[model samples]
Target: MIDKFVPSVATALAGVKDGATILVGGFGAVGQPDLLIEGLIEQGAGDLTVVANNAGYGRVGLARLLAAGRVRRLVCSYPRIPGSVIFEDLYRAGRLELELVPQGTLAERLRAAGAGIPAFFTPTGAGTRLVDGKETRRIGTRDYVLEHALHGDVALIEAWQADRWGNLTYRGSSRNFNPVMATAAELTIAQVYHAAPLGALDPEAIVTPGIYVDRIVHHPAGALHA
Candidate 1:
């Protein structure tokens, strides 16, 4: 069990290298893994490519990474925020790189990676500015553009409860991105407010199976407010 539960975030991220793509699981501030994010900031991991639902909520989410200049590229839905430091500003100022993908399509890409399907066709962004230079193939009578699956070197996930075996349970909105991201990366690092032994979590309550997780880190402080 000691091998499965890493005490510190730095050790959990020891194998992660610079310029690696990373999938960050969160819907907003609610499910954002603040502890792990703070650890990454202190770790000084730079030139990162982040895949998440949003840039961040105020300063707790991706914004913290941005402030630290650790992230170089971002693949997300929303680009700008009113009076907030966003990924676009960093990109526009030649400090960051960005690829804005449609939210649904982005989720599908990660799912495809976890499912081991290399590339799939979708009509999500057809005949629009998004399809400007992409390859288009026709299936039967309809046109579908191919989007490749997205996989990352590391996936950062947050959970409401996690067992020592790495089984994870997310509460409410936090559940949105944790389960999918668990399978979307080569190494999954989870942050939980409550960490217990292997059998402590009810089977039905587990959102992410332990098999998909590689490390579990507990914050103990419980959920954090934005």
Candidate 2:
């Protein structure tokens, strides 16, 4: 078996380069990989396109990345949050780009990428600006817009526990986007609160299988907000 564990966050994210598309798994701060975000901030690679559920709220997680001016574009469902002043200012000034996707569509796009399906049709954005210039097909009585799959160069995700083989188990709402994002990236790195020995995790409890994950970094206890 391949040992997917990495010594540190920096090591886990070592090869990340500028202008790379990154998938950040989180719903606000719930499933955000804090330590990995910190490492990326320290890595200082700029001009990033980030995909997530929402723009981060405060000075944590994706917020920190945005504040550092490393992100060039944001591809997410909800870009506005209570304290997302950084994103608001940059966006208003045209310094940042935004691709607003509907929540369910975003999830399905990532899932489609992981499943190797290039594009899929959905009625979610038919007849709206979201479907502008995109192909639309009439199915039954409704029109469906073609939405392309979303894939990333790197995926930073957080999990409750992981085995040495990189099998992951999430806690509560933290499971939101982490699992799907794991499968949709070229390099998937997971930050976990606990690291169990191989085979310690129950097979049925694994939300993300080790095959999709490339690396695992054990985050310090209490790093996650719970």
Off by over 4 Å in 1: 1-3, 222-226
| Model 1 accuracy (lDDT, Cα) | 0.81
Backbone N/Cα/C clashes per model: 0, 0
Stretch of 10 with least lDDT, candidate 1: 217-226
Model 2 per-residue lDDT tens digits across residues 157-193: 9998998888999999999999999999999999998
Clash pairs detected, candidate 2: none
Candidate 2 ranges beyond 4 A from true positions:
223-226
* Tens digit of per-residue lDDT, candidate 1, span 159-183: 8888777788878877887788889
TM-score of each: 0.91, 0.96
The alpha-carbon deviation from the true structure for residue 24 of candidate 1, after best TM-score superposition, in angstroms, is 0.6
